[model samples]
Target chain A: MRTMRLNMQNVCLTMVLSLIALGGCDRQATVSTTSVGAASGAPDAAPARKLRIGVSIPAADHGWTAGVNWWAKHASQLYPNVDWSIVSALNPEKQVADIEDLMVKGVDGLVILATESAPLTPVARKAHERGVFIVNVDRGFLEPVADIFIEGDNKAFGRKSAEFIVEKLGGKGSVAILEGIPCTVNTDRVEAAMAVFARHPEIKVLGRQPAMWNRQKALEVTENMLQQYPKIDCLWASDDDMALGAMQAVKEAGRDKEMFIFPGAGMKDVVKMVMDKDPLIPANITYPPSMIATGMHLCVSVLSGEREKIMQYMPRHLMIDVELITPENAKQYYFPDSIY
Target chain B: MRQASTRVLSLTAGGWAPAAALILVITLGFVFHGDRAYFNWNTHRDAMRQASVYGILACGMTAVILAGGIDLSVGSVLALVSVAFSMMSLHRQDSAAMTIPAALMIGAACGGVSGALIAFGRIQPFIVTLAMMVAARGLAKALCGGVKVSRYIQDADGRYIALPVPEAFSRIDARLLGGNIAVVTVIFLACVLVCHVALTRTTWGRRVYALGGNEEASRLSGVPTRMMKVSVYALSGACAAVAGICQAAQLQQGDPEDGAGYELSAIAMVVIGGTRLSGGRGGIGLTLIGVLIVGYIEKILSINNVPEYARLMFTGAIILAAVLLQRRWHPDSEGRG
Candidate 1:
């Protein structure tokens, strides 16, 4: 028992020492970067220092968020004048801590894609009060803390997809819905889709099952749904990943000929399927992950562009247009290299 | 003679507990099945397929449990191996012969380290495995750069090229036995068979149960208790690796977040199978029953279109009921079994 206690103490001590060493390295890196910026500013003989923008986003927990991370990095790389510090947090508390650290690091602006709206609003509001320019992306804050808010139209994503499904089915076929994780994004999309389905009294809604925006779970659920409903005419898979999974199940059960799938979120693979005129994936709705790139672009414009001219043109709230991706227009939205 | 007869009676009762829970769950399915979908062979086959991954993990969990240890890192290790296999096969274009063994080694190494820490360092199994869980997930994210590793690869001039998926992926995901069973299901059953034999027929198996039943006595009797613990965890890790490979094949991508929270389900399967958490008291046969019960419940709710919140509540209720049923045989034979 005594030896075990000693061993535990030794392990704890090593962990603490390594943590302190990591902190030291981080501080040194920050100091060096600031010194480099100072040296560059000296040569310009201008009063302006380098613009440091901190980008805080939820960590890439799924395909869509992974695309967000990729786009954010791609946008950051496009601007060399701005010093970009991108931090991804797994949850709201960690995101709050990251924003606080960015604030302490003295960023001129912040581009935030919150993990959750409520828990992150206060910190964003605090940053706003401290005079930091805030550009909030999808999943907006609870309060009006952002200087500019940009979000995709999830309700339209649902309504548009549902309308397309109805029109193709001639307003009479039975449909099943594969839902995403229960959140505002999911709720808005599902409720809107249900409203559209309600208008078509002839359309029999088989059921809606939450596949949690996962490919494996969607495949499993769709397989079981295939066995339950002998003839499903259309499947409204709310996300691209789930759409692909459902498509697989449909193909496996030899029912791809019987139904068409409409998935939102504009995943490149699904868009490609649409481009190829795949029988199963007939259309998709855009809830683009590139919205984060748009948010980053706006932040850079505000911080680096002529302030008066840009402010005159820019709006406080920007809703990126969501469109339908079908065979006719799938090429325009196809991002072959995107991680999503 | 009376005492011996009672012991035999309680053992049989304990053995039958898991099967009873399974029947009860099946009855619920019959009562509220989605328009008789539960009666279909395809539904049962698909349920088995869905349960296979968790079943594979539970195989290792059963072994570790019998040796008086718990492995919470299986889920994260599964994620890590999935990512590793995807990166190798999809991006690096490595053959399955190369990727499979490498992924298995990575998972075994993860489990071996946790086992060593528990056995040699005398840290609690829960804490060690928990630490392994968090660290493995982080490693998975780092390895895949926080994105799923799929078949789309970027070439020079920044254009994406679609590569043909490796043959091994589709093969592992294919249905077999005249399309009645998934390949992954076969792999799961093979794992159960191997674990069952390892736990029942071998002298090493006896040592493991003895170690769980009384560690000091096992050690005094010349059993290599420390090595036994380490091997048990390594076996669990290998099982997780196999599960990861199966997951990547079925999803056709290597998702770093694939197996998040799956450890809880694997643990639940073991416990509901009449396996005592205090250890030294379960078999792979019982775990197989537990897997089916859990799988059918999930399938029934899904086909019935039960909302997400209700599915969660029903799962919790069923787990508690099954465990309570299993507990009935415990008090009578608490002194010895």
Candidate 2:
């Protein structure tokens, strides 16, 4: 009987602690709402009921994802007529749970940048069935469950970057590739680049390694690659952060003069390097994380009763164009203040 | 078969196990030279440099494990300090002299909190450190606004200005000893030396082993077991801070998400060093061999350009093989940690 009483007390204590935690979250939400409210004029300033939109994206584990998160928050603050709740998750399970909670809150729309495509498809399909308008960004769901899908052309990102490398090497020098994590994006980009490399008979492809889209990992991998291959004329790091890291490794080896690096994703820092015409980084390709902001714009327009106006320019599947950022045109794509 | 295996383990018993494991792993390099990449001295130097951060963490981990505790918070503390150090060094333009001590203090405070919970609150080390791990990551993210703290700082006019890489950062990342050894590798060795002395020559160190061996007896013997627990964790935290500074220097940024899963590597290094996980028998010397063992295996695989999946499997297999080969069931293994 005494043990049972102690167990009951423990359970009660846990309940109180959880309640306090939840209360803290509530207060935080209220504070953000008021601040946003003040930023967009005053309370009840313009609308009868603000459309509630939920933004779910993976947590910023790297530079590109960090940019995605920043853009998502920035977009939320831009639209005054919509109440936005942004939740970033570290893994797919937490993302699924967060989406379910957003669904329970009866969000009018969801702007989802899924951590992974496979596991998020069913929950997204469920949300679609429940009449929540969906805007899927970057990573797509397995099923066509979203009202709109906005994605960057990762294949183009690889193709253009590879072509530039081939041209710069005069179609004969030995080149290498550094890949990101194994996912749809990585597969598409790497396979596309390999196809391009195969067409050029004179270009000797040294090898490729997955750096997992991390700077330190890329630096370490590049250090070993430099040692493994005595001469690499050109190198392609598929992401901007990896490019930065590989550049560091090359500099450390005192081999920066031997080859140039080509990287995708127009991170502001990388763009600046291009703008300054750094010998190591001659150019970059674009895979903008601002596609999240575009997704948010679509979500707001459709839910704000402007579906017809947006439909004139938007289709069910919107594939954004990927472009190269060279020294001559890098300034156009560079946003210095934005965090990537 | 059991008796034969037991005899083999006995032959590699005591500190000889980790050394044997190191030799065996190094022999793998001889078998597959990775197109002669393994023969290059620079490759070996880079391996040492790459392993330095994990080595530093393992140094502190040696202390915590010796005291019968685990700190999952080390990685998070590392991220926290990295972010803190980056913000001060890059955004605020603080000198290394100013930032290093502040970062170490932040890391120690984090570790001190977890220690207090475990010591005074009577919570499990795993649970307390786990909570601290989550809280520290959240704090790191909050502090940095979920972005990397890099050289790009926003001016008052909202224009992004590229600040020069701080002198302290470049110096830390630079090579020393005529480019033969990285400064970070030297720092890691210094940490190992400190932990070695603290574990081998000090009374507090003896009390830590006693606590891990049998907590109840240590407390009864007036060991001040609680204070020792707190101090060891703080030491581990300080080591993690040093690693964080190294990481930020190497990356040239303070990423809040850095060191996300490094605690496992630190733990693996300790365990592979023939340190029993139940806590009461290992030294910093074994950990050094473990560091080289793990480091060289990775360098060999990398120079070979082993595919990611194969690399993962090989790393797992090698770590397990090393630990199993070193597993001993000696009767006199109870007195030391």
Candidate 3:
């Protein structure tokens, strides 16, 4: 027993030293899935006269993208004269392949929301060079190749959320942050939020961890955060699904009434919390999945006969507003008919 | 005396290398980021909860690998089963009764086809499962009509707010044991128990190991090799189905996207457990250790709040280090899966 104990101690010392030198623990994960092609809307209709519009986006793997699908189909119905082909890609390779297929099928306009910026950029650029009217939504291409770019202001979403937390906490308190997946978009949101928190020296960030953009992951990560910090005043869950997960963890820890949570995205359930004025969730940030509809509508407007007037009036870069969902404006954002 | 001493020394140093590494890494974790959060009972309990899915999958994978075969279709089966469980149920959507059996069947059916192709049709296990992987995931997407199942959570008012999920279907993960231990952990333990017993005790267990060690020799010696191969793959499929069910329970919905790359994790666990991918060595108990190792590593880093990008690199490095150390103890085997 003594020998074993001695061995364990020696090993433990080496392990700790090695760990520190190595920088930290390793906890990474899965590759982005290869998306398959799925089509919505009818095939060619009056091919000669109608404007052919191809919509490409990521498959609805989570709550947010499901809303994208709902809006895409909804907008497809608005213009019967247009030939709409909405394709959802699962991975970068499949996305590139699907877009190539779309270009071959002869679309006059292509609206793409890339899965990853790097792979989709060149292919989208090729589509653009070929005179395709490119309308990029949510995720953008590497170059400014799109005729129009439309998205929720993620950085603003992050900044405004942190700003609200600062204002609510009177600019001083301990906060735990739950980040989504480690991506450029997620980084932009987090860094912007951190910048807001940085300006206020009084607000200390107790813990900030990636929740992998999933509800279950958020629950587990937040549980760890709760154990680490006993006196957390507020939690910036960043995303609604994450907020819901964190809220559950806090409640499971039986500190629901004590802790304040701010989860973004106008996910219906979280929106309902704002509508009901749930004590734990005082407010939320808006990053609606409905931006796809806005993109689709804009593409139609740009391609319509009034193109000269529309181009003069509408800007090439369009940032949809990020609203704070308090009890007052919660009703407008609540869409019962929408999937997400 | 010298031989015995070396046996003891090697057992301590090499046989338990993964365990030693696990403890060492965890201790380092506490040293770097330890506090109430890093060293608590709930943290350990949640660690087990997190490991549960891979624990379940790895247990069955140990058997499949011991039979000198690999099954890559586990992830696809997980996707299929989770989607089918949600889409197949005629009654209440989240009803455990309707969901569990249907998931298992779908998993088994996917496995059965792959097994048949590999065992009887004489295709490579890798090829068979690779095809099954894409086909199964495709079917899952088709079944869900390519939309995420919405799930829900309750508010302070005790009012139910639905999140459009067929994703809301998971309520199983919410069940707790004394408010600390997750029911998911219990499910994982039960699977480990059954797999461990069946792998170590039964005549079939011996056959599985023997076939993996030497299929031609085992077959000539009256072991039913072909039947065993099919059974192992089927068992793997069924195990994956259980994992899918648990994931749905935990996530509270059927995610067609769930378990997308989880098979690699399971295979990693089984391989780390000192199970020779070339077959003929290792057991389910070893896999449990691997699952715990990976689980604890994930938990430790998460609690420590390590920079997210660094997490993957550290995980890969340690997995490499531990496996390399384990390989030196067994000079001949590739020690890979």
Candidate 4:
């Protein structure tokens, strides 16, 4: 009882302290503090002097985003003249604040992989309006609010993988898709694949389930699918980890001889299997997570005078082609140093 | 003795509602699809296996709720524990002994800190646990340096194999009793039974109800209210860690994002089991039925090849109906809530 009063008093005190703390921290905190290149805080600067590039990306919560963070850092070292402040925010609100902070700090250019496309468009547009060169990666804004847009084609990835499966089955077979949860991006992949399958009169369209993009859930879904379909000719094991999962279930049930799985996003091990010509491991589609590195490199290049003038004819919207890697060309796509 | 008997009768009465609903769903599926593949042992077992993690975490959440506390940090704890276990396994090739204890300890320590703040620091459980939730996830990200820990796995023959290959650690979520029941399900049931005993037949159990019923009254009556509050959270933390270990074994990867948003499902189980949100009421027997209800619904939907969004909508509808039914039946507790 004595503690309750003390607790109430402490609660009030803590609330007050936190308000003061939040007030003190309204300026925001960022990962990289030291600004390299010219002190752009001053108006005048030399043409050869380096400019500040701000990279705002989603935090490394999973394998892919971690790869993005890794590449962002790696891109910094490659461009010694330019200053890069790579800040990863956990959510969209933090990301918005991050962009505002970068704006306040007067970054010459901005590179962003939006936490989500729509909510981030306004801030991105603001940066573009302020004469800050904007490079959008992976997720594109609703409006053409950037100087350059770079992304792997989700639709192409779906269409090509579906085409490979149909070709392997000689245009007629039972195929089931193990979807990576129902997100806008994954749905694009599945719907495009389904559209292609719909064109083939010989192909039978079985049902699909969301594997939640986790290995264990995919394993369970695959195990259940195996039971439901006695003869599953091909599986769209779309994610690399999901492919690994579905493969495990097939191998355990000794059904590897009958079916092949196509996992995407080119994780190192999966690519290695395709390279070694593992019988069950047929091929994978390449949608590299290192697009952030590409975005970073471009941000530095376009901000510089030489590369921008030389590559003036380059389109503002660049879709990095997604490829299907078989044993023949698997070596070309494999990045042994990739985190994914 | 007489009080205990009436409580048993009340619990039995509460159990019949969800149990009957479950039976109705299973029988309806069979009745409707008599000829088609509307049923299978493997699918049912898979649902049970998947539900085991929820069951274990729900049992722990029940204890905390009964003591007038809520734990929003279980999911983060699960993620943290998973990384801790995998990181340990990396150091010691055969890490079942070391990893299991280390993971559990990390979970308990994290929860203990939250519990201590709520008890001694006089902060609200919601705020304290919420802080812990964010901090624990950040800690998990930091522990693995924000990457999946892919150390090589050692097979049964003492040969080292790469991580993509399923190894002995996968045995944690493997089936027992000739592939009928999963190891996760077994641990879940064991935890449920033990917690059922601890929350019912002990003096501490009585103290739990007293504290939740009226904190001031309980403290005035010489109840060690602070310790009970702290220990319940500790127990919840340990149970979440156990679920994490089972998850790590099942996935064969130390995913930092493992068990994300699992706390909501676990809490849903507790509430759908006829547990009052106001606390001081509910037991594990009814919770078992709640677990089965959710499991059977998901399995039936997936087996029927229902779309993912529709499956989620149905689950939400069924759980909401179950809660409404409980409130309708126990009209007297409605005011208390």
Instruction: Go through the candidates in order and give each one's C-alpha lDDT.
Output: 0.80, 0.80, 0.74, 0.74
Assess chain B of each prediction and give its TM-score.
0.93, 0.92, 0.87, 0.90
Top-scoring candidate (DockQ): 3
* Model 2 vs truth, CA RMSD: 24.1
Q: What is the lDDT of residue B75 in candidate 1?
A: 94
lDDT assessment of candidate 4: 0.74
**lDDT tens string, model 1, A1-340?**
6566445434533443343234334434543533345455665588588887888988888889889989987887787677777777765544765675566557789999998665476578779998899999988775688989998888888888889999999989899999987566787788888999999999999999999998899999999999999999999888999998998999999998898888888889889999999988888888988888888888888988775578787898987778999899999999888887
Report the alpha-carbon TM-score of model 1 versus the true structure: 0.52
Give the CA lDDT, 0 to 100, for residue B179 in model 1: 70
Q: Write the residue-wise lDDT of candidate 2 on B1-337 in tens digits.
A: 3222322332244567567557756776665554344676666777788789999999999889978999999999999999999999988998888999999999888888888889999999999999999999999999998777876555787444567879988899788877778898999999988887777677877777777878998899798988888898898899889999988876667878789888989998887777767776667888898899888766655544332344556566556654444333333444324
What residue pairs clash in candidate 2, if any at all? Answer: B280-B336, B280-B337, B281-B337, B282-B337
Model 2 — TM-score against the truth?
0.51
Per-residue lDDT for B1-337 in model 1, tens only? Answer: 3323322332364657567657766776666544345676666777788789999999999889878899999999999999999899888889988999999999899999999999999999999999999999999999988777766554775444557768878899788879788899999999999988887778777777777777898899899999999999999999999999998886667877778888999999988777777777777888898898888776665544343355566667656655555545555434334
Location of the lowest summed lDDT over 10 successive residues in candidate 1 chain A:
A15-24
Residue pairs of candidate 1 with colliding backbone atoms: none
What lDDT score goes with residue B285 in model 4? 75
Error of 4 at B159 (Å): 19
Off by over 4 Å in 3: A1-21, A25-340, B1-14, B88-95, B152-171, B335-337
Model 1 misplacement above 4 A: A1-340, B1-12, B154-161, B332-337
